[model samples]
Target: MTTVVKHATIYTGTEKIEDGYLRFDQQIQAVGPMADYHPLVSDDQVFDLAGQTIVPGFIDVHSHGGYGFDAMDGNADEIDQMVQKMTANEGVTSYFATTMTQSHENIAHAMVGIKKAATKNPVIQGIHLEGPFVSPLFKGAQPEKYIEGPDLKAFEHWNELAGGMIKLVTYAPENANCAAFERYCLAHGIVLSVGHSNATRAQMKQSLATHVTHLYNAQRELKHREPGVTGHALLEDNIYTEIIADSFHVYADMIKLAYQLKGADKMELVTDSMRAKGMPEGVSELGGQKVIVQDQQARLENGHLAGSVLQFPNAFRNIIKFTGCSIADAVKMASGNQAREFNLTQKGTLEVGKDADLNVLDSELNLVQTFSFGRSFNPENN
Candidate 1:
């Protein structure tokens, strides 16, 4: 049976339809202005979303965990619970279970758990390996002891344990033997992202990484004489940069500057959120380190920033508030860009044949509900 949502303003990722209607069942069957909406069957589950807005569901490719669970826990049940709560509270229809730099055994265990959970939860699109191959100088929340240079064999072993579900990797460009690792990732469908690095602009230019993780954080900064990793990210036209748009992670002006340079198509808004998210401010754990969550920030005891506690819906709203971009442009950063960069072929847009992953928002842009693969979830209820 088909599901229909009509009388809503729709941002289709490619276009906007005022008073539009969407038809779907697992995948989108049709999308157009209300004039083109026609009932194909009488039993279609029709919802009148009058005075509401719909857009492609937000996708967070660089989140660690949320709702009191970390992906590194290596517990399939916990991972499932975390993903479900994330979906309910943040309108995150799709997510990447990002892992931190950890011991070989621990990382492998996490891979196995994520793989197992993914079999039951399609929301777990893939894994984002955020460490074990990063710069110790910029480890941030990542433990320095486990950080190492790029090693293809180690990654292959972990990927094998993950059932080949490793979709993205964050490694410093200055690391040794990166060429081979980059080639392997490219050949196998893994996206290489540069992060936690002290690499200079020239070094970044030499790398084949098309994505930058949490731009301007845990990476080399822009300098007058040497445009570091941050500068390289801003200068590159093809790079897809991830920004943690929580007012705390980045200032509004910097986000505006990035948007001005990269525009919405090249900049992706990621939560980069940790287990502290969706919970009250307090102590939390990330990558074996104790973190204090307060003032909307998560930080280590040494005053270094840990992961974030930002929710996806707030990130979506912040992009607009900070950059003054339109809903369509914000949609690109929230969902469309990640889909295009990660080759999530069936997602990121509202059109015929795409997955029915979308969010419904009120007049003020607050998420009212979400439909992930044709199943409805109300945020207020969660």
Candidate 2:
């Protein structure tokens, strides 16, 4: 059976088409002007969007957990609950099961859980290892006891436990023996992202040369003399940067400046949400460490940011409001750019032959409906 979504303003994430229509089976079959597409339909389920905006479903390259469940728990039932919560409420059709920095044994255990969850849930893209090899000076909320120097044996052990589903890894480029680790990751088709570091400008640049294509612009700040990680992220043209875009993680002015400098093609928005995301403020556990959530910010006892309680939808809205970017541009940052960075060819755009993963939003940027693999799930039912 085919579904015809008509009378919508389509932001393909690459282009905008007014009064457009899209036809799909399990994948997008056609996208074009409504008039040109009218004759292509026959006995199809038609949904008149009534001018609502239709865009590719948001893809989060980095996110930990949400809806009172932590991805690091390594529980299949708990991970499924997290996926349903994110997909039903926030329109995240696909995401990485991110793990926090933990002890070697704990990280291995978490990878086992992520592997099981990915096998059960098709939307679980892959695993993203976010620590264990990072600087103690900029560990943020990561437990100090779990922080370790760069060790290939540990990586190999984790990879074996994960059954080789680890798709992305995050590490401070300044860590000891990082150059060898970077080469290993690149050789194995794993994406290496720099994050949670205090590397200077020259150090950051040198690290980027070592096959680090992505940067996590979460904790570091910009400085004139030091430049820091954030400066290299903003000034570099070839690197893809992930911004929290929650207005609290990064200032509005800096968000706007990043958009201006990198454009929507190279900037991706991620939530980095914690277990308390989409829930009330209170105490929570991030990778077995205590976290206090107050006023939507998750922090450790030492005043370091633990993670976030913001969802991808809120991040999208904040990006638009803060940067004055078009809805299309904001959507591109959340979907298209992420797909490009991760080399996911068939999951990002609304073009023909792509997956039928899409989000339908009202005029005010509120999610009205979503489709994952042609199965429509309404958040109102939740």
Candidate 3:
């Protein structure tokens, strides 16, 4: 059966069209002006969205966990709970189960759990390993005990454990043997994102030249002399960049600057949220390390910044408020741009021949409804 949603204010991640209609049968079949659609001739279930905005369901390329469940917990049930929470509450139709820096064994175990979760739920895309290969100098909330230098053997082991389901990996470009690892990741269809490093501008250029395609710019700061990886990320046009957009991780002006420099097409917004997200502020565990949340920032006992408490929808709202970007552009950052960057051909945008994943938001920007693979899910269930 076909589902036809009409009379919607459609934000197709690029343009806004009032009184638009979209038709889908497991996948998008057509999209155009609502007046052109005839529900009488078509054997379809018609839903009138009134004037609510319909956009592509969020695609979170980088996230740790949410709703009191951490991805690194290595529990399939916990991971499933986390997925349900994100999908129901935030309208995240697809997401990467990002793992924090942990032991080789722990990372492998977490990957296995993620693989199991993804097998059961199509919305849980794959695993994003944020480290074991990062620099200790920039290891914000990651435990130093788990941080390790780049090793091909470890990478191979992780790959095998994940059943080749690893989609993205973050590491320090300046780490030993990183060039070879970055090349290997590219060869295996894995996205290598530079992050948590103090690499100089020259090192960053060299790293990007070698095959690294993405960079994480949430935690790192910009300095005049150092220029840092964040500077290099802004300067590089070909590479995609991820920003947290939580206002605390980056200033409003810097978010605007990144969008201008990288263009909205090349930028992806990530939550990087921790377990404490959507919960009351208090102590929490991230990758086996104790973290304290106060003043809207989460930091380890040792004072290293841990993951964030920001959810995906909140991040989207902040990006729009801070950057003055159009809602279409902001939605693209959350879904379309992310899908394009990760080469996820099926899961982003509301065009024909794409996945039937979408989110409906009211004029207030709150998620009103969500559909994943043509099935509607309720946020109140979370």
Models sorted by TM-score, best on top: 1, 2, 3
Please provide, for model 3 over 254-336, each residue's C-alpha lDDT reduced to its tens digit, 9 standing for 90 to 100.
Answer: 78888888877778888888888877788988877788988777888877667788877788898889888888888878899
Give lDDT: candidate 2, residue 223: 75
Candidate 1, residues 279-379, lDDT tens digits: the string is 88988888878999989999999999898999899999999999999999999999999899888998899989988999999988988889899888887
Provide the clashing-pair count of each candidate structure: 0, 0, 0
RMSD of each: 1.1, 2.1, 2.3
Pairs with steric clashes in candidate 2? none
Candidate 3: count of backbone clashes, pairs at least 3 residues apart or interchain: 0
How does residue 173 of candidate 3 score in lDDT?
81
Q: Give the Å error, residue 57, model 1.
A: 0.6
Q: Over the stretch 212-251, how does candidate 2's per-residue lDDT look in tens digits? A: 2134444356777776777777787876788888777777
Q: Which of the two, 1 or 2, has more TM-score?
A: 1
Against the true structure, whose TM-score is highest? Answer: 1
In candidate 3, list every pair of residues with a backbone clash: none
TM-score of each: 0.98, 0.94, 0.93
